[model samples]
Target: MDDLTGGGAPDSTGAPLLDVFMQGTTFFDMVLTGLPSQPVPGTEIHAEGMGSCPGGIANLAIAASRLGLRTGLASTFGDDVYGDFLWRTLEQEGVDLTRSQRVADWHSPVTVSLAVHRDRAMVTHAHSSPVPLAGLVSDTPITRIGFVSLDEEPEPWVSRAKAKGAKLFGDVGWDPSGRWAPEELTGLGDLHAFLPNSTEAMAYTRTEDPRAALMSLAELVPVVVVTCGGQGSIGIDSLTSEEEWVPSLPVNAVDATGAGDVFDAAFILGTLREWPLRNRMAFGNLCAALSVQQVGGSLAAPGWGDLADWLAGVRHAAAAGSRSAAVLANSYGFVADELPSHPAVSLRRAVATIARMSDA
Candidate 1:
């Protein structure tokens, strides 16, 4: 964790030092896992296990922070128990929330997630925030990166952050409206990178193939990445004319919530470290793969310690004459060079509840 912080110290400018800055809504997520099957309509079913955590933008925030990036989040929280839990949980995870506020008499957003069949279905109840995101951070702090959602128009603070030299990474959610309008991506020119799953990318680019979509998006953003779930991810760096395709790690996915956010965090970390484009994509894919093995979204994010353990396991298996493990070990050999001499052991992990408990 110490090595992963990326040395978040303010320069002579005296601005809040941060590696990643994010602004968005936060949700109190209740995740029920290990269900035998999806519930039929109007039927009651029992889950084998459950977990709770802060979700939404907090997913990316915790993901970045756990990876040792100085992370800061700006958003509104309701003056309620759920909101209080979210605030404390994020703070405990070492996320800086100085730009966040607690609104009076507002209801916190809540999401109930059902994780079954290696995927999840969510029912969310949320209202428009009392305050807009632009009102949360009037002066964007100097940071190495900023994360944004391309579901709507870019916020004013996003442009301000870009002007302040923050490289922006943008992602999009499923368009419930199904318009997938090309105009929705008009803000691509202002972003340093844009990551969209193959479906979203093809729909927006109006291309039949993922690579074609990636090429079409490359014409707009400097970096374009299209994630193809089981098949892997394809990316193009226009500045360097580098095109890379990294396959996904084979893992038993328990819940895929927030996996994309974790991937984005890992990719952002690699980009900040100036790693090779291929390594960046592979690292992101690995992180996302690890994240889906757990139930909770933010709580399930893996730290550097987790990466170290996974690498060690892969090498051990490779030494035991497992062909697949040997191949995987070779593919991720670069991770060894990036790990610290001694990774932190007391790193965070998914829990069944968000209640505050003594470290003891």
Candidate 2:
């Protein structure tokens, strides 16, 4: 991993790469403890701690900057202590937050993250949900940044950016019917690329299979990119004759937070370079593979140089690992939900099925 602060790393071709600018919000993380177990009712949990950085749009900006683009983060925050920390962290990540502002007496958005083994639970308080800015667009001269991602909220500049021929992209995080205030969420159609995870896709389309959900989503958007943890990911590239499937890279798993975000960033990079679907998927898989090796989200993200080097070295073993991931994804999704129900779901049964396939 490279320094969290600004630093340069030479790419495979031997050139120094630096952080770029991007704009977005600073989150107030209220992460909880007691992972690998369900939350007990009436249990008292603490904020535990807090960290600051450009999240959402800001995260995408920091990643783009790290890969050597001058990225800028434009978002809103209150004049609270956390807001101040957010600005500093963005600067540290080399994200240009010049356009972001500190509103007086406004509270920043906060989310409580809970871990239950491989699954994660989050409860959010979006205090700055109704962020309003006079000038939300930028006239600043930024180089060709074809990739853009949004966590939530709509920036009119995004549409203008697309009109200027910049590639616009984003992930539809999630909007639960029963719980979430769905009106606050935005519809995901009309994007150069629309990335959504299995959960979100299912919720939107009301389907269990990822393929069916993606196909349904394609009616609204040209390209529907769906991210599945172990199954890797797939996207419909209409530019080509048919859809493309990108396989996942194998890794010793740990934390799953930010894996989807990392994958989205990698996909954008691969698309900008016009890599083949396979290579694009490989880049995303490798990015995700490295992410789970460490704890937390951003901390686990590998520097581009380190990741490229790592990929260059792995060969057939990696492919086999991907097949393993596919087998798991196909049989039981990415989670271990079968063990408790021996009648249908069990890792042992899944393994036996896999063994039979291999043996045959």
The prediction achieving the highest TM-score against the true structure is 1
| Cα shift from native, residue 89, model 2 (Å) | 1.7
Model 1: clashing residue pairs? Answer: none
Predicted candidate 1 versus true structure: per-residue lDDT over 221-334, tens digit per residue: 999989998888999998888999999999999888898889899999999888889999999999999989887889888988899999999999999999999999999999
What is the Å distance of residue 286 in model 1 from its true position? Answer: 0.7
What lDDT does each candidate get? Answer: 0.87, 0.55
| Candidate 2 lDDT score at position 252 | 64
Backbone clash count for every predicted candidate, in the order shown: 0, 17
* Highest-scoring model, lDDT: 1
lDDT of 2 by residue, 196-313 (tens): 8887776666778999988987776666788888888877766664576766666666556667767766666666666665556666676777766545555345664554445344
- Could you tell me the lDDT of residue 128 within candidate 1? 92
